[model samples]
Target: MGLLIGVGVLVLIALYFIGIYNSLVRARNEARNGWSQIDVQLKRRHDLIPNLVETVKGYAAHEKETLEAVIQARSAAVGAKTPGEAGKAEGMLGMALGNLFALSERYPDLKANENFLSLQEELSATENRIGFARQAYNDAATIYNNKREVFPANLISGGFEKAELFEIEIAAEREVPKVEF
Candidate 1:
């Protein structure tokens, strides 16, 4: 009877550890999926940028400095390999885009152009999607970080990768951009 009871206890302990390992795996996968969602939205944003720059270029050829800044910012954003790098690059891109829009306010005809208007609307919608995706990624990272740091889970979490939250690193980027047409 004593030997049978010891074997049963060992089985239960093994099952408990397995459960913890599985939970850790699930949380890590969720965090990864969340980051993937953000990447998809960012890709859409990247694809739209050149079209926007070209449309603006037709009207504001003399605004070479502003246009080039936008292009360069977009390139940096596309090349960013980590969440921290991406946040900084994207913040710069957002500021550059805001500058481009504010510059448009100076030209009455460009603001009214149908193609420009369509692009602006599409960009605005994509921005909203990006915002949501960023939020989701942050939430998932928080959850995974919590799971890994908790008492019992910490013992086996040594194999798990840490997730970094995507943050807007610029104070200026936090402000509501003026969207006047």
Candidate 2:
């Protein structure tokens, strides 16, 4: 009877470890899927940029510096391999794109152009999607990180590394300032 009781307790401990391990695996995969969604949105945003730049180029020939900055930022963003690198590059691209748009305000005809308007709308929509994807990715990473750090799960997570959250390095770039007259 003593031996049987000891064996039963051992089995329960093994099962508990197995359950925790499985949960860790699932959480890690969820985080990867979340990052993949963000990557897809970023790719869409990158693809739309060239068309948008070209449309603006036709009207703002003298604004070569702004256009080149946008192109360079786009290249950096497209080349980023990791989430952190991508976040930084994307932030730079966003700033460059903002400057381009500000320059466009000077060109009345460019603002009125149908192609430009359509491309601008599409880019705006893609930016929104990217924002949502980033949030989801961060949420997934947080869940995985918490699980890895928790008591029982932490003991079982010896083999699994903590997932990194997608973070924006430039906090100032993330905010818009209000202008009061």
Candidate 3:
């Protein structure tokens, strides 16, 4: 009877550790997947920016400063290495793009151009997708962070090096700027 009880206790402990490790792994993967979702939308936006800029250039050749600003911002965004950096770069790019579009408003003919209109619609939709993806990333990160740091999970996570937090978010100041336009 004593040996059976000891064996049962060992099994329970083993199962507990395994469950904790598995949860940590699942949480970490969820966060990674969430970040990938953001990456996809960001890449889509990046791919569209050049076309959008070119379309605008055709209509507003004299707006060199605005166009240059947009190009610079896009370049910065592409060069960003981390999620935090990317967020800030994307915000700057958004502001520059907004300026470009606002300038486009001055040219009634540019606004009337069917190609420009189409690109604008697509860009707007992509922006919405980015917002959704960002939300998902934040949620996943929160879950993983909580699990890895919380008491019971941390016992196993710390011992096994189960999961590590990802550095994808920064302070509000560094986050993506709201698109007011």
Candidate 4:
């Protein structure tokens, strides 16, 4: 009777460990999926940059520096490896875009151009999607990080390191350029 009870307890412990391990695995996958979501948005933004730059080029022909800055920022964002690096690059891109939009205020024709307006709308929509994705990624990261650190989960998740916290890519200016005004 005593041997049977001891074996049952051991079996329960094994099952508990297995359950926690699975939970950790799920959380990690969620975080990864969230990162991929952010990646998609970033890629969309990158693809749109050249078109945006081209549209502005005709109107702001003299603003070579601003256009070059946008291009450089986009390149950096594309090459960024980690979340921290990506955040900084993304912020730089945001600043460059803000400058690009400011030029629109200087050129009424550019703002009124249908092609420019449509591109701006698409960029705006993508930015909104990126924001949503960031929120989701951060949420997933939070859950994963918490699970990794939590007592029982931590024991089971010992093999898996804690996931890094997701950074919110807020531009320094904190506001998207109101280029239309």
- Candidate lDDT scores, in order, read 0.84, 0.81, 0.78, 0.83
Summarize candidate 4's per-residue lDDT along 1-181 as a digit string, tens digits: 9999999999999999888888889988999999799789889989999999999998888899999999999999999998778888888988888888877887889989999999988887788888888789889989988888989776667688776655644663223444435
Candidate 3 wrong stretches, greater than 4 Å: 82-85, 159-181
**Candidate 4 regions off by >4 Å?**
81-84, 167-170, 173-181
Which 10-residue window of candidate 4 scores lowest in summed lDDT?
Answer: 172-181
**Runs in model 1 with CA error above 4 Å?**
81-84, 167-177
Clashes per candidate, residues 3 or more apart or on different chains: 0, 0, 0, 0
Per-candidate TM-scores read 0.83, 0.83, 0.82, 0.85
Report the Cα lDDT for candidate 3. 0.78
The alpha-carbon lDDT assigned to residue 72 of candidate 1 equals 100
Q: Report the lDDT of model 1 for residue 20.
A: 89
Ranking by lDDT: 1, 4, 2, 3
Clashing pairs in 2: none
Q: What is candidate 4's CA lDDT for residue 27?
A: 89
Clashing pairs in 4: none
Model 2 residue 28 CA deviation (Å) reads 1.1
Report the lDDT tens digits of candidate 3 across residue range 1-181: 9999999999999998789889888888898899789789888988988998898888888889999988998999999998668878887888787787768768899899999888888887887777778788878888888888888777767643433344554233122223324
